[model samples]
Target: FSEVSWIPNKHYSGIYGLMKLTLTKALPSDLSKVIVLDTDITFATDIAELWGIFRKFTDKQVIGLVENQSDWYLGNLWKNHKPWPALGRGFNTGVILLYLERLRRIGWEQMWRLTAERELMSMLSTSLADQDIFNAFIKQNPVLVHQLPCFWNVQLSDHTRSEQCYTEVSDLKVIHWNSPKKLRVKNKHVEFFRNLYLTFLEYDGNLLRRELFGCPSQASPDSVQLQTALEELDEDDQCYDFRRERLTVHRVHLYFLQYEYTPTEDDTDITLVAQLSMDRLQMLEAICKHWEGPISLALYMSDAEAQQFLRYAQASEVLKNRKNVGYHIVYKEGQFYPVNLVRNVALKNANTPYVFLTDVDFLPMYGLYDYLRKSVVQLDMAHAKKALVVPAFETLRYRLSFPKSKAELLSMLDMGSLYTFRYHVWPKGHAPTNYAKWRTATTPYKVEWEPDFEPYVVVRRDCPEYDQRFVGFGWNKVSHIMELDAQEYDLMVLPNAFMIHMPHAPSFDISKFRSSSSYRNCLNTLKDEFHQDLSRKYGSAALKYLTAQRNM
Candidate 1:
């Protein structure tokens, strides 16, 4: 309604965007919040109620969880197509959510003009369609997103898109018939899709266990049979079960602990354990020799930090045959890249099904991967978070980086070092597992990997994607890295364990060190002032520290 432009099949040339293209800009205005539901959608339930849901989140910025509801027959045409990285089974533009203020602040309108429009007609012929246009926004402002449930936009009658309606037909919130033709309930397609929901969410290898292989249902039951079994199980914190098949051959990774100080002879608990840094080589060698899980070393380093790492690796018996050890360094190169880049890189290179990212210095307190393995067993494959961050990845040294001598190093450790903003996650109710609430099958679960490391997380790689722009070596510019993060990958953070930046003891005050590091001294007086403004603007943003590094 702002302004109008005309095209052939589509008309949005002026203020608005092409109908085929959807939104003309990346974000909404600073003045108000807006929700744009696509014209193709048919709402079978009350999504109008969602506005109330939006009101509850006054401080947090967000976009609506889009349910890709493009028509079924038409969907088959594009099912193979990879559209917005916000990725669902497909792109259905029936419903969309937007935030105007952030959009204007980030120059989204200009970005849209630059990225979305190609000549006048090219806008009419873009590939991302409307959602791709929106994805550009979604990736950068993920925190501003709200992941709506799939039932909100039911694509009815795909392989099983409409499966949940059979059992919970009355519970349907939004039925989005986004198909190309005017879609309606024809055959009992909705009912079949509804019933099949239970099968998809809980599907495991139970059938394969029983069938031609002749394995017993007790030995391994089909998912449907397992569903009957789970009815007997209760949800208890301490209670968990494993697929019997997993009992056959199990591989475990051990996290070693800190070795800096020697505790008093009589004070057994307080004494610093002897150096495992020395044994790491031998221990890892043995683990790699037999166990297959990946073992990662998490250490904070700068261009200046000593390569005791290289020495440790050199000492490793496995390194004598480097192929077996599988050593890799994970970190971003740019000064503005966040500390999480290192973790992201390590996870990326990890090959085994079970990847262990542990501190080279300190190990977990209790000798345990058993309780965690049991926790893993209890996960609803469809509902489980793939990456598991444990209090396991830790060190003995506390805050050593903050030492006064490490001042310059501390400077480098400050915020806004990361080039891109984190991505939005798939809203919970929208996940395939929600079918279980209605006694339906769950869809296979996956987490999009757009790394945002504030509160800790450990995840299994489902769609283990990284913004390739940030990967390898690449020079970055404003919004470009964020643009890539926005276009590809979804990020989720789960509360759990964290990576301990092991210090020999709580000797250094890294934050003070950061304030006083070499980078600070080298910076011009202007940067010093700008640094203050930046800290205020981004609020402990990693980029400020990185920017100071860049300035240095």
Candidate 2:
């Protein structure tokens, strides 16, 4: 085949052999018939059935094939040849039964010489390469071609075409998916073909599940047992309390440390701070297992809820034996959760030189601690004012079981899905609202625009704390972000580092709170009073510092 000389077309260069039908000329003179099949086809019947078609061809016919089911050829050739059916809309080359002796006797090489002419070659190059040339040759000599039954090459491009030909799956002899959109589960012939394809391989449930849903092939016994238990649990029971049984039944822990960085004796100073409320025992356990450093957890709830958590913690041997974990209770009266106040209390208890402020639900990915440790060591702690920010993603709402590893958790995040900003500028304010633009970056960059503080922030011990006055959900942390900007500090967003936020039901109704009078009053105070106070404290220093940072 390689000895045959052929003209190369840029569009069809990859399949040059198919474009020129090079194999036909390379065959010996004794060979009379040849059947060519495309790779994107499936054979339902015996190969002998396809070979039987060549016997029906007439003495003058050189090729026997089915017409293309689509109007794609007509559209491509319409510029040169007008009207719909003038040149007889082409045939599909996918299933071709050719009489090699008849083609050689007809002087097929003359067609290649005509295609090489400068004027004709330019025209053929612009059109669909091989198919167009074959159609033109057949049009010039109509007696040299014969049309086969549509059933011989069943086109599954359009589902409607199936009704015109084969009505049942067993009737199909050859299935050709020759359309731009290939065979998907949504396609009409998918069910018919999928069942037949699966039958050829002796269907295995475990292999199919792993291929479809990314289930681990070599999952440990503990993972399999936990998955089965979770499926058997009642849907109404939101809180499952069987930590001791899980520990005894499964030899391995729920989560494992994949990697840990060893720090110098003098550089071992960092604390993770989080604020928790009722019905968050599962999240607390995950955080304890995931982090390798010390943690300062502030539990903000009623006296009864605090006691409930304590009982659960004592029952679980893993949490009870951890000496590095410390708990602080901030007993509150009302149903409203004070976001900033509890966070402030947790930050205050952090005794390390650097502290990471985050929520209990956020689970840091593996290697996050090592990345942060390296970042902090390179920074000038005394003179450089900076805060490290990490990207956060929420899991799908319907997913019940937590992933056992960081790679598993990341595979769950839908591609091209970005987290929506929790807080937007309310009632006509001049602030940028599109937070997704930050994700276009691939490396750490400074946040000079209106940045939100909803993500986890790692800062020095002397950095300004959250304001305690702003109560529940709305604009609590955002106000602190504004203050940090006004104090001339750099907010660097790390695009590579990530933390997955576990799915859960909302603690309170967001729409009801947004419409209440108290919420409107809080918005007013934040814009008018807070802005004025910051301006009075540092009038021009903020702008000057911002200019210097941009220059750097």
Candidate 3:
């Protein structure tokens, strides 16, 4: 983008704006033409009609644009107003049709550069960077531009003075809010256009769909009324059944926040990769404060929750200002947590070479970020098949102040204020961390893998992704750990680094797993199938290892 020579001013100086000049080279060779548009515009007609206008372009015309409707370029509205020179009226880059093939043939790159260089000597700077350079180029070569009608781009800026374009509100084909004030623009017919925008905002998208067609196996009988629908189906075919709902789901918005963090060669920091729903959003401030490193979060939410989250994040003092956090939303059509799916989303988005895959509920010990970085280098785990485990603990007391160092945590452990995570209820989960050994060791110590061991670890980003087949509760995390063992990655405990899980209300899946026998049966079936699949993938040795661990 910096390759384009353009003068920058306060209002319009983003390097991204200069990217428009390089479209011919940026895009593929086969793409002959493209219509670029600004984000702050509303289409009043089908965009296909706008694409049709390209058919009328002459052989010499390489760019199609609508002329500027405002006096910003006219240099008459304000005192000492000086805009970059435009022939009669400057064109808007907001709505552009670039003839890439034609632009390439004319050596468009050199032409734009030369045009900008010639203009900058007379006009020191430009308020509209790309738009100014474009107008200056067209001034020199008038035959290369195809002028679009004013109706095509109905500008609604402050004192646009476009009365010559249209008489009624119905004349607008595309409404470009080309002003800082946006909807509050000083125009005659602002209300009608504002109402049209509001109408689309309040519109219900689901009302447009006639019927669901993707789930081919599921029957959609019109004969079954809404009332007593569940009673009519078999016990195994309930809508709330995990298997049934899971199959009907279609994943959407997989990478909602794309390229939030680009990997750099020198980036050796550990990124905290986690998943959470809207309920745990407040936990972010604490987690980020303690870690002070990059975080990639996968947010599982509905469409409505997504909108609410954006508003919440904006209002949040800590979240809105932070540049280290990347929030990616993954929308699925079911009530299940889809835990592994969410974990994979976070894992894949982490730009750093090392990632500490943990739950959102856990808060790291202070300076764990720097400790992990130092440990990775000291242990030489950057290129080795090793997983550096961070010992996890939990407390029964709800209002305990977080310990800042290893000494304070050990003191609390001696006082029985904190215990190993899920120590009594589910010992197998973090027991493999060997808290007894972790307390005495001052350096990274090797811990043998055990079945169902899922301690939070800082591993390389290329570690096998969580097996997405397991959803809800039960075998989700265990399946991932089992695969790591089969692949022969050693799990070593980091003595200084630790994470403490904050107490929270039990999730719906956990409650179901305890009370509902049917849910347990379904989970057991899934677990057995997962074991068989793992055995087939890693051979009989993997099954023998699991059996040996279970016997112990």
TM-score of each: 0.26, 0.45, 0.81
Candidate 2 residue runs with Cα over 4 Å from true position: 1-264, 334-336, 398-443, 451-453, 509-512, 541-552
On lDDT, the candidate that comes out on top is: 3
lDDT of 1 by residue, 290-344 (tens): 3222345433332222134566655665544534233443221223323234444
Clashes of 2: 0
RMSD of each: 30.3, 23.7, 6.3
Writing each residue's lDDT as its tens digit, candidate 2 over 1-552 gives 343334444344344534446545777789998888776677777778878878888889988888776565566534755322214556767788889888888787676456445335345343344555567666667788888777767776642233666565557777776654555624565677666654642433223224555534698887788777767755553212221122222111111111223434755367788877775667877777777687777776554555567678778877776756667766553345666667777788777778777778888766676677666776554457877776556554545354544345445543423233232333111123223544455556776635333446778877788875555556666677677777767877765566767767766625546667755554555445555666577887545434433454
**Candidate 3, residue 438: how far the Cα is off, in Å:** 3.7
Query: What is the Cα-based lDDT of residue 199 in candidate 2?
Result: 61
lDDT at position 475, candidate 2: 61
**Count of backbone collisions in candidate 1:** 70
TM-score of 1: 0.26
Error of 2 at 290 (Å): 2.2
Overall lDDT per candidate, in order of appearance: 0.37, 0.61, 0.80
Ranking of candidates on TM-score, top first: 3, 2, 1
| Backbone clash pairs in model 3 (N, Cα, C under 3 Å; residues 3+ apart or in different chains), count | 0
> Model 3 TM-score?
0.81
